[model samples]
Target: MVLLDMNGTFLFGGDRFGPNQDYASTYRALGGSRLATDVVQTIIQTCFDTLEVIYNDPTRSDSFPQVVDTLRALPAARGVPPADLALLERVIAQHELGRVPDDYAVSLQKLARSHVLGVIANLLSRKDPWLQEFYRAGVLDLFAVTVFPRMVPASSHRGSSSTKQSVRWGSRAPM
Candidate 1:
């Protein structure tokens, strides 16, 4: 069996927290036109800042709050309807998750013919968007197992080694 990380590996281009991010444009492109650009920008920055705090902490390496929850808690998001907040989460995910290229999908298919493929990804939001992308790329069924942070319960210790083992061995370990 082969294990792989999703971001920066098979998938690329998640730059939501990068310096060149333009949150407002992404928001508009994704049907978010009610909020002003500045407001969108502020909300995006706040999300980034909050995630950065958690990501930068060595002790919090394996823990993360859902991105949608983070967006909902922002002052800039005040009065934004739940539907809009959901859209905002997608906007943030758009910047954070890249696409699976046709070439990579082809490669994955080829690799899966000989080796069992599995995805071990750490995502701040739900895995639906990435799953949709995988389905779109026609590589969703290529994996023997897909594991994301939210799919596993929080452990007392850091890292996901035990969780990975449980999933790989077919243990009913809350995954």
Candidate 2:
């Protein structure tokens, strides 16, 4: 099975880009304010809590100062969503290829040519719309299996002692 992590795997993610305009604008219509650092902080704290549960380690906490320092260093994230320091740290990492590796697409295409290609991923449901962005970007069509976490039920979350219960992937050719 060709398992791949989501986010930086097949999609361009991070705080540098604004939210899906439709969604963001809708939130605005509903009286949403500028995304605050606290919102970002809560996301980080949730990840840390999940990690703590996994490792059973309380000492493993995140450093906000370090994150802030790192965000200031990213050229693309300057000025917008100023509170995305944590997003900056998590999203910026070396991947199999640039942003979305060319080799990943090539390899998936090659694999699909002969074998049943599969992708098992741990994903968050709230982020599913971004998958469509990759489709628009022409990267989603290369996979035979694309797993996401939204498909899982609340009961399944405890099955593997992991926060994620299931992945949402496709058997159909990427569209």
Candidate 3:
């Protein structure tokens, strides 16, 4: 059984979330706010840090507010005002719940042929957001199990830990 990450590992975020592209869409999603290069870096760093906190502690609540609170305190916020945290969450949730690139589908199809696949996403938004993405991408049915924070609140799933003791473990049966 192999566990996969849902956000970046599986979803490319439609190309705005990779090398040298931290929080790319997020800048625009904040509503026409042009961040200075250094400020953008701070925002991106803070975003990742906030997300890690969520992943590290799934039981924690008010995650969106946490991100906002952290950013609001940053010196960068003075130059490039932080977007409305609620709106920020809404925008990210929208992307995660929307279309996945064709490459994701192709890769999933190949991997599913011989192995059990599961999605372990450490999301800031509610679990429904990711489910909406997987369903819209038509790859929701491919996974043996899709674990979200709501379902597996205690999982320390970063990668390949194979904590089979966790929730909803799947098995592959003989044909």
Candidate 4:
């Protein structure tokens, strides 16, 4: 069974600031506001944290707000103008998920003709916005299986052994 890691393997991830926005430009756009390198790192880190928080407890709605509150305490957000924060919020709302290239659909279409395509991602969820992303990208049906962290025990979330186990146990088609 051929396996694929989703990001960078087939889907190229977007910037920390979200779709169509790059980090440098985002930092520069902050203008007078002083956003420290560490704060920027925190912003990026928060992206990952948000996913985990969502995965662990899907009912929580405070992840983004909590992150912003923390950023507000740092120089990164000190006196941050409303407009800049709005942009940041927009980026955060996007979940920093990247766009799938046109070629990916074409390639997936071809690959599915013979090989059984599946995804073994550190993806946070298998539900909407996430799963819907694949649908929106027009490649949802192309995947025979999609493995996500929430689908397995917490220990399996980051290890290769767990990933292999997920692929083995989670697949809809035979491996």
Choose the strongest candidate by lDDT.
Answer: 1
Question: RMSD for each model, in Å, please?
Answer: 4.4, 11.0, 7.6, 9.1
lDDT of 1 by residue, 1-175 (tens): 7888997788887655754678889888999888888888888888888977875776765555667777878888889888878878888788777899999999999998788778887676667788888889888888777777543434533564654222332221222
Residue-wise lDDT of candidate 4 within 1-175, one digit each (tens)? 4667777877776434433335434455545255565554566455545555554674432222233444455454667666665555444535445667878878877887788877776543323344556777787777777765334544334444444233323324655
lDDT of 1 at 69: 71
**Model 1 error, position 78 (Å):** 2.3
Q: List pairs with backbone clashes in candidate 4.
A: none
**lDDT value for model 4:** 0.54
lDDT by residue for model 2 (3-117), tens = 5565566544332322321323333343445645444334334333343353343332121113334345444335646444433333321111124456655655676666555
Model 2 clash tally, residue pairs: 6
lDDT of 3 by residue, 108-171 (tens): 8789887878877645445666666677777777777766543332334343334312233334
Model 1 TM-score relative to the real fold = 0.80
Lowest-scoring 10 consecutive residues by lDDT in candidate 4? 60-69
Which wins on TM-score, candidate 1 or candidate 4? 1
What are the models' TM-scores? Answer: 0.80, 0.41, 0.47, 0.48
Local distance difference test, candidate 2: 0.42
Off by over 4 Å in 4: 15-95, 124-127, 150-172
Error of 3 at 39 (Å): 18
